[model samples]
Every structure is written in structure tokens, then in C-alpha cells.
Target chain A: MPMTTTPAEPVTPAGPTVPGEPAAVAEPRRRRRAAAGWVLLPAVAVLLVFFFYPLATIVWSSFTEPTVGLANYTALFTDGVSVTVLLRTLRTALIVALVALVVAYPYAYAMTRVSRRTRAVLTVLVLLPFWTSVMARNFAWYLLEQRDGLIDRFFSLFGIDGVVLLGSVTGVTVAMVQVMLPFMVLPLYSNLSSIDLRLMDAATSLGASRPKAFARVYLPLSLPGVVSGFSLVFIVTLGFFVTPALLGTPQQSLVSQVIETRVGDLLDFPGAGAMGSVLLAVTLVVLFAVSRIAKPTAALNQAVDRA
Target chain B: MPSTRAGRPRSIGWGLRLWVTAVAVLLLAPTLVVIPMSFGAGQTFAFPPKEWSLRWYEEFFSSPQWMSSVVTSAQAALLTGVLATVIGVAAAIGLDRGRFPGRELLRSAMMAPMIVPGIVVAVAIYGTFLRWHLNGTLLGFVLAHTVLAVPFVITSVSTSLAGYDSTVEVAAASLGASGWTVLRRITLPLLMPGIASGFVFAFVTSLDEVVIALFLQTPEIRTLPVQMYDSITLEIDPTIAAASSLIVVVTTVALLLPQLVRRRRSES
Candidate 1:
């Protein structure tokens, strides 16, 4: 609006009032776009080579590395322990996602009610552990859960023993939930902040209790966050190797450790590749299922359409 | 929330205050332990540490081995920070400022590296590099970490650019400026905070990374985390405490730059 109008006219040039001049004017725009493509082609090429190729390479390696033809993937299903671990991994992922929501939603809601400075500080604290090395976090948890660790001392002070939270599946699950809580929290906080407080007030004025107001007015409104958080934590939790490796006993091994053992300890490249392929297959199927649930673009449309 | 206003949680509720204080202290438990451990007078990794001394800190400064790993990690982090930030800033601008095909796909791909398990990527890259004979080298670590760190740069810089208006660039261009000139003169200043945030994030990620360092580590070139891993897993010692404290200090500074900016922004 504030522009000197002459410059705008030259770019768009009430063009083609003179037909030959239209092509002259359009030519540079086309070339500029074409030039952009040329500039972008190298980046796209890098992605294809680095990102796309490795994904395909692992898939192919699974099949062809050892005497060819589905041996690796087939071996995973055929091996009972592998199948069990995959199932356990999925189970753990779901539980983590569930626990993250349970823990994060209340905190996020509380965050929204707090003053900006308080929220900022809290958000920083929530993000603090994340900023540190995951290894460091895991080690800290290890220390806390150890026999002589702080938590153990506290429990022992209360005269409790035989408490094995660190090396158990439960310990790993709790750690995983802690690890993924921020993923669940941030999206919810975004959606929650966007909500006008009046909706809850309106619900309350109409005789709804706090829980009722949250359920009827807030929950449906925040479905996008729930979906996003669930998918994110679930997908990430599916790929986790570190927490399990650090916290879980041998029996609690995840698919990642299996693959690592195969490749690193076993030197069975084909088997490792095959296991990777199987995990990839499951991930794709699970991802598709999640995308269906997330309906991300559709959710945006729904939000837009709501307005 | 306001129902509890007069006699409850926010006002005269000492119980609530106590709970909040307790929770905050509980949250800080792990971080606080680092200090006591750092000051351990004993050679063991014990809490309450038997006594209090700065011997480990002295050892950290005196030991060339620990210092070299710190130097290597810093170099790698700096290189990764710059590389990731440049590529990330370019990609962020390209995505936000330019309309292009497959933009969403390109973005998802760019951000995907961060989501991929560090071990998986490390192992995959190790496998790839083995065939190309790219292992056991600093360049390999740099390239691998640059890839790992790019997603953070992209996410942060993208969010920063979200607050940006592209019409300014268009206006600049229409005012007879070239694209590069418009970007240099109009865009860079606004994006500086975001780029710096991304830079810090990249540095932190590079510094803290261990899984990738593990598979890529050779005697010739290894980072702090790798050394920590080797030290702890092989021979437990007090030196590790000093190293951890030092990284924590550096990391706290790096991580807080964006926070300071945020606080300043909020204050203004």
C-alpha cells in the first residue's frame, strides 16, 4: 500500500496490452523460476543421495546381503525373541505416549494459567533436561535408581527393599515417558494457549464442573495436539535405543539393541540389515496408521472450517 | 482456576507454596548432585563424596588427554554449528521466502534426520562410510554431525522465520534490489537471533552426541562424550566428574543465549 505505484506496474506491467511485450515480460519470470529450480536441484540431489538412498539401501541390504530373498525379515519373524521384542517395543511406545499425555496435559493447562514469566521459567526447566546429553540424563536416572542411589536411599529410609525400578521394564517405561513428555507438552500448550478462556468460563457458567468443562469444551478443541503428540512420541519411542540400553535388563531389549547386537556384536551384516528392514516395514505400517489418525492437513482444514 | 483465588492456592495457601517449592527442588535434584560429585575428595564416584576438594578440577586442567578431547569436541561443534546454521538458514529462507514444488516433502526430509535414532544414523553412516573408506576421520564425524544437527537448525530457524514477513523481501525486490541484496540488507538482521539459536543448538547436539561418536570413534579422533563413555565404561574415575562439570558450564552458557534473547524480548 505504501509503495511508489510505478515499480509495481513495471513488474506486472499491465502486460500483454501489447502482445509481443507479454512474452518479453513473462520470459524473465519464467527464467527466474527456472533458475531457482537449478539452484534447488543440488539440494534436492543431496537429499535423494543422502536421505532417500540410505533408506532404500537398508531395505535392499536386508534382502540381498546374505544369500538373498527375504531371509533377514523372515528370520526376524522366525526368531521368537525378535518377534517378542518388537511387540514389547510397540507396547512400550503406546504406554509412553499415554503416560506423556497424562503427565503433560495437566502441566500444560497449569502453564497456560500461570503468568508469562512463570511459564517461561517452567518451560525452560522442562526443556533443561532435554538440552543435556541423553546419555547424561540416562546416567543420572541410573544413579537415582541405583541400589545406593538417592531414590533408593529415600525408599530404604522408609524401610522398603526389593525395589527394582531401574533394571525392569517399568523403569524403562517411566524413563521413556519422561523422555517424551516435552513432545507431548509443547503441541498441547500451543493449542491450549490458542483457546479463549471464555469457553471454559462459559461452560462453568452453564453449571459444568472443571472436569466437565475440560472434557466438553477443551478436549475436543485440543484433539490436534493429542494426535500430534501421540504420533510424535510413538514414532520416536519406536526408534529409541538409548534408554532401553541404559535402563533395561537383557530381557527388556528393544529392536534397536537387537539390530546393534546383530551388526556390532554378531558381525551378521545381512541379519542386521534384515532386522532393520523388518523394523522399517513395521514403522511404515505404523506410520501410515498414525498419519491416518493424525489427519494433519485435514485437521488444519477442520480447524479452518470451524472458524 | 480463579475459584480458589481468595483463600486458596494463589493467595494464602501455604500448602500450595510448599508443594511448588518441593516440586521445584525435586526437579533440580539431579542437576544439584553434579556439584557434590564434582567436588569429590575421593577417587570414587560416590555421593557425599567422602570429603570436598578441587583436585579433580586441577586434574582436568593438567591432563592433556581430557583437554584434547575437549578441544576436538569444541572444533567439531563449531564446525557443525556453522555448517548446520548456514544450510538451515538457507533452507529456512528458501522454504519461507520462495514458493517451490515438493516444499513439504523437502522440509519433512530435512527434519527427519533429527528424529532418526542417533544410533541408527550413526551405524547406517558408519556402514556407508566403510564402503567409501570414510571412517576413522574428523571429516567423517563433522559430516555426520552436520547432518544430525541440521534438523535443529531448520526447526528453530523456521520458527523464527514464521514471525517474518516475506512481503518485505518482495517490496525490496520491487524497489530495484536483487534477491541477494534484498536478503543481505533486509532479511539477515531479523533472522540473526534464530540463526544463533540454531547455532547453539547445533553446538550442544554435537557436543553431547555419543552414539555417533561411538561407531565413528578411532584412536586418532574422538570427542568428549566418546572419551566419557570410554572412561566410565572402562575405568571409573573422578576426572569424569570434572569433565562433566566443565561441559555443563559451557553448555549452560550456550543453551541460555536464546533464553536471554527470549527474556529480553519479553521484557521489551
Candidate 2:
């Protein structure tokens, strides 16, 4: 196996004695290599037993339950409520990604232009919300969107009266955009900062207008960041549970809500498992597609590294 | 137009800064709003409170149900921190020091939990835990949360290990120090900051986690987030605002503490 070969080749010459001593030294080095591999066992075992095992069980049940053979999958496709929720979930994710991108772009751009002290403050503003509990942030939104609450009262002052945001798609979208904005900003900022400002200077020196220089020289360069940020926000919004559940009503229910309902209220385990499987599959597919276009992991690591 | 070229971008920069400031305000609004709301004397959540008091905070402290959930969350988070850091540090060392085929794959698999949607993992665990009868147990909560928390620990520890010079271990070994001795005396002490930060990250992750906790919660066992969720969805009590504010303060402090320490260390 490649596993045995890769470590053995390097360790052979580095064995306990001179390079000429082959058989005796090779044995202990091999044993050490094997022992090093065994260090991975606890983590691997934990993941297998607790993480992958449960996930596999869910996939298994989705196939086998209710006298199996694709029944659940078929039902998921044919069921009107399920299909609508699935589509709505996708649409919501797309909207949240786009909205967050639009809102985050100028801020992330401005971050690149700011002094180091100002940029540090801006980064904290971005990350504070990111680190706060999802439930806390959602609860704050829930209160704000309620009738005669902060949002409604603020709107009423402008003569925009009787507009209820709670339980509406607007409220859910606003909350999600707020929650996902940091995800968009961090990656975009990392990518933007890495770009050499000299490129813009060069374009300007070539007699390109500032806007033209930005569009032609800068935007395309930051495309990888945009792609990475969009996919990150979209995938996270796809499975968003807390904000929507707290703020949205049945009319605006997303797929996670449906999964929660199926499992939590209805006690339909296999059905929920099928929905989860679909969500997981779609998430992985989107990640795979995004990876083809941009290195999401590199963007993520850069952002985290900056933080 | 020479002056225009120089002045135009500065003008745009000012406008962008204004826009960015507005966005920052919008981002901070929820956290800032909740703190004042937590002090509202009214029974229900209302803005610009006519009365301000600490009744809700007192309520949160006095209520056994709320207090118990706090205890439960702390216990689970603490256990998860210890368990995840130990396992994650071992995995990181193995991956960093040991070169073999499938090492990349193993590392990716370790990180899969972070990418997979939380609800899917929650549902999967909920289903399997139902069979294992681990649904409401503390061990169940720790194990499931550790699965989620380990990835962060690994990421943090791995970053630290990347800067670490492994030849130090080779030198120690050559000087007659054993493997365990080298790890104990040399490697771990050098990696202490990363491991500590990883522990805090794991703790915060488990503390903030709600999806798996939601699935695992029973009447007898509920974490703070799950309880807060129930309060928001099922009741209109403003005590949750108090609870939420507390979490915001505590988590911000916890998250920033390591950075502060690191900065001070660098300065020194």
C-alpha cells in the first residue's frame, strides 16, 4: 500500500545507525512509523464511532425505512410541501448570499483602504457578531421585528405604518444577511488585501479612469474572494436554522425547519433523515463546484489566519 | 485634472468610510440593543424602556430551570474542551510529524464536521442516539459536541505546529531524551498557547452550539442555548434578553482573552 511505502522511504536512511546498516535498523524505524500512524487512531475512532457512524445510520435509514427501496426519496421529490420548502431554501440561500455580498463589498473594500488601527476596529466589528451566539443574535432580531418593536416603531416615524416584519421573509432575510455578512466580509477582505495596489496604480498610469481601472484590474483579481465568500455564505444560509426558525413563520419556513418539524414534532425519523441527506448532498456538491472555481479552503485559512 | 485625479479617490474613500461605518452600526445594533433591553423593567420586550432595572438578570439567576441549563451547558462545554483538545492535539501531531499516504484524506475527514451543515449532523446524531439511548445523557452531549468542536481545535493546534520546528524533537532525542520525555518537556510547553486557545475555542463552540443540543435535549437536560431557544419560540419572557446579553459578554471576553494574551506576549 502507498501508506506503508510513503513513510518507509524517508525513514530508511534516517534509521538509528549508519546508512549501511539495513535490516536491523529498518525494523525499529518501521515500528516507530507504525506507532506514529497509531496516534491517529483515537481521533479516527472517535469520528467513526460518533460522527460518521451516526451519519451513515441516517443514510441507511433513509433507504430502509417504511418498507424501503427509494420510497422516501420518491416521496421527497413528489411531496408538494417538501419540494416547495426545498426550493425556497435554495432561493433564500441565493438571496442571502447576494445581499450579504452587496452589503459587505464596500465595507470590505474600505477595510483595505483604512489605516491599520481603523482596520483592526472594523475587523472586530465584523467578528463580534460572528462570534456571538446565533440564538442571541436571532433573539435580538426577533424582538426588533415584532409589532410595535424597534423596527416597526422606527418605520412608523417615517409614516410607513402597519408593516409587520416578524414572521415574514423580509425579517428572515434581514436577519440572515446580518448573520452572514461577516462570512462575506472576512474572505473578501483577505482576498482584497492580498491584491497589490500597484496593479491599480499601473492601470491608472496607463490612462485608465479610476472606475475603469477598478473594474478591469481590481474586480477580476478579487473574483476568487467573491466566489469563495458567496459559496461560504450560500452554503451556510442553506442550512441556517436559528434565525429563520425564530423569525420566520410557516409561510416562510426553510428546509431546516421542515427537517426539524419532521423529526421534532412529527417523529418522522426516516423522513427527516432523507431531507438531511439531500441537504448534505447539495451542500457537498456546491462546495465541490466552488472548489473547482476557487480555493475556498485557502480563502478560509487566510481569513482565519488574519483573525 | 491632475488635482482631480488625486482628490477623486480621496472623496470616494470618504464616502466608502461613511458607508462602512453605517454597516458597522447595523452589525453591532443587535448586540448593543440587547444589553439595554436586558435591563428593561417591563415584563415583555420593549425598546427605549420607560423603566430600567435588573429584574431580568435577577430572574435568570434565581430561576432553577434557567440556572440548571447554564450548569449543564458549562459542564458539557468543559468536558468537550478537554476531550476535543486531547484528541485533536494528538491528531495534529500525528498528521504534522507522520508522513504517510491518506494523511491528507484523514485531515480532511477530521474537518468534515465543520463543513457539513449542523442540522444534518444534528438529525443524524438524533437518529443514532435514539437507538443508542444516548439522547439526553451528558456523555451524549459531550461526544456529539466534541465531534463538532474537534475541528477547531485541530485547526488552531495545526497552525501552531506549522510554526513549530520539529528538529528540536530530533535534537532532544539525540541527547538521550525519550519520545514521551521530548513531548512532555519540549514540544507541549512550546505548543501551550495553541493548545490553550484550542481549548477555549472548543469551549466556546460547545457553549454556543444549539442544533445538536436541541436534538439531544430532554426535559431533564437542556443546554443554555436550547433553553434560550425554547424561551424565544415558546414564551415571551424578556429574561432571555438578559440571558442573551450575558452570553454575549462572556463569549466576547472568552474569545478575545487569548488575543490579548498573545499581544502582550509579543510586546514583552
Candidate 3:
């Protein structure tokens, strides 16, 4: 957190909490137990009402409204456009995650070698775009990548409009990359910052080139953060709506957009629910697989501080 | 970023430094372009304007619709900040201290709103709120944003809680202090940074949010991102630039101020 100078300690919140009054020492334990139970109910209610209920409703609606079974899913799997769009969503997410890593690794490497002051500034900068609405920032990329837009003008001087991006998959990828880059960068930076500098130094002193040192030592050590970042971008990208909506043609719709159209355009709640249930199932499977290997503290970049 | 440490080169191989710079820039190009494009001063969004003008700047301020929308967004963001911070902080504290059943599952469930697609929530809220007669009110937007935003508050506040030293409270307890005193004097101060982090995240989440806003906002109560969405689809004038510019300024300020404070806090 930008509020402190050192790595914070992990102390669970149990101190001096309503338990140590002059004559109330004995009374506080019972009250503390009561308080803990009280906390449990609200937390449980919030998660259930907001999360499990909606998701379960989606699953129930998908199978029930259209008739309970994986029939909707069966239709999805057997249909021409359905499987293609699903695969496209996953493939695009993978590409975005891969590109973001390729770009973030070096920036993170340079960042790890910086001073505290510079590190803070860079961290803030990395997070600033994230702080703004991704919709707006994605629009910024849209404007930049628009045909004959800002980026096009620069390339125009060299007779290169074809290279300019507007509605192509590359344009969508570029915008999505920008939106997801911070997701990739922050974790990598934090992980690198947390790395012991001695290892890198030792690797270099042993005659490994900088790249070699980074590849052999820094890279391996930072695997958790890398995996964390990739999963962060990957999962979010799977459910992405705006980037593809703004940048890609109708044919290029990802699963999220398909769900959006099914819900918003067609008013087929059951079909939409079916699509959502599928995505949720896939996400849980992937995340479970990821948790099996590396858990990003079960936090999972929650909403871009991220989040 | 010739990233050396402590007044000396970090022993990084020179051959790799350029490679790093090139990739970083290539990666960071989209971020860098916002500056120049933001300064573009023509009627069109052409990157390098034929002529420089502050007319869009003037237009953004003078347009009542744009001005009012900006105000609406700030209002929503402010409300989201307060509600999310309070509820999120409370949840974080409870989760950190208490170990009841299904706590892990609860945490995951609460965090799912953030991970789930905004459109999914938008659709669900649209249907739910329409039934509740909450279709186009500021209250609906707040409640929706708050739900989406709780995870940020939880994560950021929990980040702070994780760093908190339970021993301090223990010391306070041993010294004949009550829980209230220990929390007031010791815990809150230490957790200020994390709390601030939660607050900022909440603010930004509300501001940048469009999916939920789309389903919620009436012409009577459009937030900035919602307004931007309308402008993007409804009209193609330079006024949206003015809107974009205002958002850019406010967002940049929001992003920079905490770092400034945090930097000053640490340095002094």
C-alpha cells in the first residue's frame, strides 16, 4: 500500500477488540464470541444473496426454463457459432495474457532495479490507468488506434494506414492489452521487488549475462507473480465485454458479448443464462486448476486494485 | 529506465538494456499516446491536429449537459466510496479476526462480483431492479456499484489488515486498555493507508463503471461513464472530447494525489 515504508505484517484483527474493560474482562469473551457469530451471518448473507444466488439462478434458469439438463449446453457445444466463439474467447484471452507478460516482464525488471521513490511513482503510474474507468481508457486506445485517428496520422506520414488499427482483432487485442497491462505489471513488479537482489547479482557475477540472469534466476523466482498476473488477465479477459464490443465486428464476439446479446438483444434469459453458466463453469475449472498450482492469496485481482 | 541502484549501475548487461527499453515502450505506447491525443485541438480526433485550440476545453466547461454529467459521476463515485469503504472495511475486519465456518467461501463469493463480467451484473440488476421499481434512480446505481465495489474494499482493507500486528493490540490489552482504546489509538492509525486504498479503489470503480450504469441510469440520472457511453453512441461531436478530457483530468488527479501524499508521508 502507498501508505507505508515497509512490507506490512500479517496480523489478524483480534487485538483490544471489545474485550478488556475494567470490570468487563469476563463478559467480553462471551460478547466476543457473539460478535464473531454476528460477523459470520452478514458475511454469509452477502455472499449468498449477491453471488451464489445469482449464479445458481443462472444455472437453474438455463436448465429449467429451457428444460433441465445440459441441453442448452448441448446445443452450445453442437452449434456452429457457439463453440467457435467460446474457443475464440479463450484463445484471445491466452494471446492477451501472453502479450501482456512479454511486455510487462521487462518493465517489471527495470522497475525492480529502481529506487524507492521511483518505484512508488512507477507503481502509481502503472495503477493510474487502472484507477480510471477501463471503458474510458479502452476508448482512449480506440481513439488512438482508430483508422486515420491519432496513431494513424503518425503512420500516415510514412504511407502506412494498413498498419493502423481500428476494427481488427489486433486493435481489440491492443486495447485489451492496455486495459489488462496494469493487471500484469503490478504483480510482476511487486514480486520482483520482493525478490532478493543478491540472487540476480550472484548470477551476473558468475558470468551470466543480464538476460541469462533474468532468465535463470529472476524469472523462476517471480513465477508466482507471473502466474498470478496471467490468471488475473486471463480470467477477466474470458468474461470481457467492452473491448470486443467497441473494437471488434459482430462476428468476433467473445463469450461475454454473446451473453450480452442473448440477454439484451434477444431477450432470451434462459439461453443467456446458459451461456453465463458455461463461462462460470469454465472459469471455475481454470481457476481451480490454477489454485492447484499457485494461489494469488485467493484474492485474484478483485476489480482492478485488483484489484 | 537505465535502472541502476544506489548511485551505481545495477550490473545489468548493457546489451539487454535497450531490449528492455524497447519492450517497455512498446508495451507502454498506448498509455503514452493519451497525452498527445488529449492535447489534440481540432474538431476531429486526429492525433496531430491541424491547428491547436482550447475550444474543446472551453466546450467541456460551457456545455451544461457535460457539466451536469460530470457532477453526477462525482456524486455517484463519492457515495460509492463511502458505502463501499464502510461495508468493505467492516467485512475485512470481521474476516481477518473471525474464523467461523464457510469464511473462505464467503470471501470468494464476495470477491466474485469483481471477477464476473460487468454485463452479467448489469443484466441481472436490470431485471431485478425493474421488478423492484428501482430502474433509473441514483439509489439503484449506488447499490449496484456498491455490490461491484465491495470486493475492492475487502481486498484493499484486507491488504492493510494482513500487515497489521496483532501484538500491538495484545500489548494494549495487557496494559489494562479496552478494545475500543486499542482500536482507536493503535489499529485505525496503522490501517489508514489500507483504508485510503480501499476508498480510492471504490471511487475509481464507481467512476469507471459503465456496465451496471448502462442498465441503471435514466436520462434523469446519468453518471459520467454512462454519459460517455451515450455520447459515444448518440453523437459524434467534440463535446465528448470535453467529457473525456474532464474525466482524464479528474482521474489523473485521483491517481496522483495519494502517491503524492504517500511519498511525502514516507520521505518526511
Candidate 4:
């Protein structure tokens, strides 16, 4: 009777039904939804096995391996090189984030002011580096920053002779700013484009000069985008590996390089895991703080959709 | 949009325009520089090659090591694309329509891979893969890459899903069509463009990925990016210029492919 009932039942939401047969009528729809729920299973299962399991393993090892009770984590602070590297990495990330913001803010603002076609071209410029291979870009910087390379030669034109950028923290910082520019621009553009230009005119008409109006009205409105973009770049630069490894010297290595050496060369899994945990903790902390102000993920998704 | 002043144009001033142009040039310099550098005939990794030749390209194609790495990368990317898309699209649909209690949590979890730092991911996966015997294997690379690629696929597919009207699907189902029939005739066609783009994104994510691949690589199973990394760090190989150019061309075409597909679908 149950099987036959499903076959004869009207599937339409508007179809007439007996007064007391609501449960029977709703049964097939619920069954259909439950069937659709099965589709989520494979993805959840795969992530559970492949993604979460591995991450959990590292988190576990950080505390458990090489004897438990926080020995590994304590070493991260007591070890001279690790603490210094962590601090330097944070300093470099802050500098990169600030420089990228200064460079990207005007470009993103200009993107909002341009004609439609010109705006599209500007958008591509921001995305161009994003799609470029990381190794390739780092290699390009390696060539330009080498001793007596183009950068040095150009500096020499101003009588700043014998300047070498390669193997210096300055070189790594310069290359990273370039790599991080797109991340900063996309979010800022998305936020800036949505702002009404009429508001700026309104401020100017209210007895304010152009620069004063921009500083007072426009800057506050754009803070959400700025914070998210700045935080995103800062978080990414903190864990950077390739650019620093290629363009920077061992003495100037960032946190990522330290982690790499511990894990890859030293095979010190517990120590590497502890340092990685700290990096993850820092990233999550920044992400949470930024999420309180702006929706980085949504802004990122919107930017990608537009692209 | 007109200017308040008689002679003042209502557009960005020259200062901002010049600044934007400079920033754009800085953004594009690395990609633009690599193409010319790829043509250098000399041994040094210099720009504006004194001698122009295709020697690096010849070397890239002629060497078995370079060719094998390319083949391995392609194989891994292809598998990652397929795996990520199938599961990612399904999850997107489920999250979009299915009534679930933890839907928001699930969505965030799906995007977690994108936010997690690459070095942490590499170390974590490398540690577990050592125990799982997945280290230095193609399957290992594909699995690890799929985790990263899934987020891109999910984002692209979810974007397409946002514009999709589900009422049409309901209409089909109420007209005596089976669920499978409705999905096959309605949902797949509408979601094809998104799915295609998601596939492209997944492919590119895997191909461009380096940190995780760098750890997983063995002498026998190196991907192109890893090989490129070695060529630079171990020794300065001008042949990497050729490889970099090839990657740029390949990625440009791959990223552009979905846009082309969407255009054709719209025109038809």
C-alpha cells in the first residue's frame, strides 16, 4: 500500500490532498531531499580523510611527539633561531602589507573611476600576476635583483653605485610586495566599485574641499576593504616560502623557510609541527579579527566571480 | 558625471592615471620579462639576450627529465580536476538547496583549504603521507592537490548556482518527470558553464601548486614546478626560461578556455 501510494500521489505542491493525508503527501518530498543529502557525503568524506586527517596528525604531533606536555612548543620559544625568525617574519609581513596597501589603494580607486573597457583592462592587470607561475615570477625577480643586475644598474644611474639587492631582506620585501599586490587590489577594487561616487560629490557640496572630503568620508567607508586586504596579504606573507627562498639569503629567512628546514632537512617533525601550529594560530587569529570587520571570503568570491 | 568646473574633465586626474599605469606595469613586469628571457641563447639568466635562439626550448623538449615532469604534472592536474569537480559540484548543490542543520559550518569547512597556509598544509600532508605510504606517488599528489583545488571548484560552481532559478526544476519534476530526468534535462545544461570553469580552476590550482608538490616529490615523480624550483635553487638553468614560457602559454589558454566556452554557449 505504501509503495503504491507513492506512485499514484500527485507530486505538485499545489495538488489537492485529503485533509488527514498531509504526512503521506509530504513523505515523497522529504524522501527526495534526504536522497539529495547523500550528495554531500562524498565531499565530506573525502575532506575528512584527506584534509582534516592530515591536519589533525600534525596538530597531534606538535604536542604528543618527542614526549608530550608541550616540550615541542616550549622549544619554539627557547630556540634562539626560531623566535628570531618568527619575529622577523611578522615584521616583514607588516611591512609588505602596509606597502601593498599604499600601492594598491590608488590603483583600485582608479579602477572605479575608469570607463568600462578600461576598468576591465585594469582588472586583468591585477589578475595577471595571480595567474603567473610563482616560480617563474620569483626567478624573474632573481634575475633583476642579482648583483650588478638591472636594479643595481638603475640605482647606479643616480650615483648609488655598487648596490646589490639579491640575498638581502630588502630584495625579498620588494619581490613580496609585487606578489602581494594583486591580493590587495582585488578586494579593494570590489569594495571600491560598489561605493557610490555621488557620495564624494555630496561631501564636496557640503563645503568640503576635494582632499578633505576624500579623507573624511571616503576613507572611513573604505576601511572594511582595507582591513581585509591588508590582513589577507599580511597573513599570506607570513607563511611565504618560495620568494624568500629564491630571493633571500639564509640569514634573512622567514618563518616558512625555518619550518622547511626543520621538516625537510632536519626531519624534526615535532619542532616543525610546533612552529607550524604557531603559524596556523597566527593566521587564524588574524582571519578571525578581520572577519569581525569584513567578509574576506565573500569579497574574494565576488572578485573571482567578476574575473 | 559632468565636472563642476568649466574646463575640468570628470575623470581620474593624470596623477592617479600615471600611478595606476606604474602599478599595472609593476604587476605585469614578471610575466612580460620571462617571455623574452626564454629566447636567450647565452648561459646566464639575463634579460634582453645578446643572442636570440630557441636553444632552451630545444633543450626542454629534448631532455627526458623535463619531458617526464611535464607529463607527470599534466597527469596529476587532469586527475585532480576531475576528482575535485565531481565532488565539489555535488557539495555546492547540496549546500545551495538541501535543508541541513550545519549548512553554514559545512560551507566554511569546504573553504578552509583555501585559507590554510601552504607551508603548513605541505608539512602536514608530508608527515601523514610518509606513514600512509602515499609519499612520492602520483596518487598522493593528486589527492593532496584535490583538497586545495576543491575550494576553487566549489566557489565557481556556487557562483553559477546563485543565478540559477530552481522553480524551473520544480516545474519539470511536477510534470511527471523523475528526479534523475529533471536533473539531467534541466540542471546539468544550466550548470555546464560553471562546471567547465570549475574544472579549469581546479586544473590551474593543481598545476600552479608548488609547496605541497615540492615535499611530495621524489627523484622519479617530480612535477614541473618542482623541477623548475630545483633548476633555480640547485643550479641556474636557462632552460627553466623555456619551461616558464611554456607554463605561461599553457595557463593562459587553460584559464581562457572557460570564458570561450561561456561565450559560445551564450551565443547559441
Cα lDDT of all candidates, in order? 0.66, 0.83, 0.70, 0.83
lDDT of 3 by residue, B1-268 (tens): 2222322434344644675656555544565544555556766666655666667767778877777877888888899899888778777877876656777877776787866655566676666666677767777777777888788788887888877887676666667776567667877788887888788778878888887777677767787776666765666555565556556677778667766786689889
Q: Write out the backbone clash pairs for model 1.
A: none
* TM-score against native, each model: 0.85, 0.91, 0.85, 0.92
- Kindly list the per-residue Cα lDDT of model 1 for residues A23-74, writing each as its tens digit: 4444333333333333344345544555556556765776787667876777
**Better structure of 1 and 4 per TM-score:** 4
Best by DockQ: 2
What TM-score does structure 3 among the candidates reach? Answer: 0.85
Q: Ten-residue segment with the worst summed lDDT in candidate 3 chain A? A: A1-10
Candidate 3 wrong stretches, greater than 4 Å: A1-30, A40-43, A201-214, A297-307, B1-9, B19-47, B167-186, B258-268
lDDT of 3 by residue, A1-307 (tens): 1112222222433234454444334333333333544444554565566545656666677888767777887888887898898888888999999999888887777776756665565566676666666656766776778777767778878887656677777788878887888788877766766788777667777777766876898788988878878887888788877788777767777887788788767877777777777777777777787775555434334323432
Model 2 Cα displacement at A254 (Å)? 0.5
**Chain B TM-score of every predicted model:** 0.86, 0.90, 0.84, 0.90
For model 2, how does the per-residue alpha-carbon lDDT over A49-163 read when each residue is reduced to its tens digit? 9999999988888899987688998998888788888988899999999999999999988887777657777888888887898889988888788888888998899999976
Clashes of 1: 0
Off by over 4 Å in 2: A1-33, A295-298, B1-12, B254-268
**Per-prediction share of native contacts kept:** 0.07, 0.53, 0.25, 0.51
**Model 1 - which docking category?**
acceptable
Cα shift from native, residue A150, model 2 (Å): 1.3
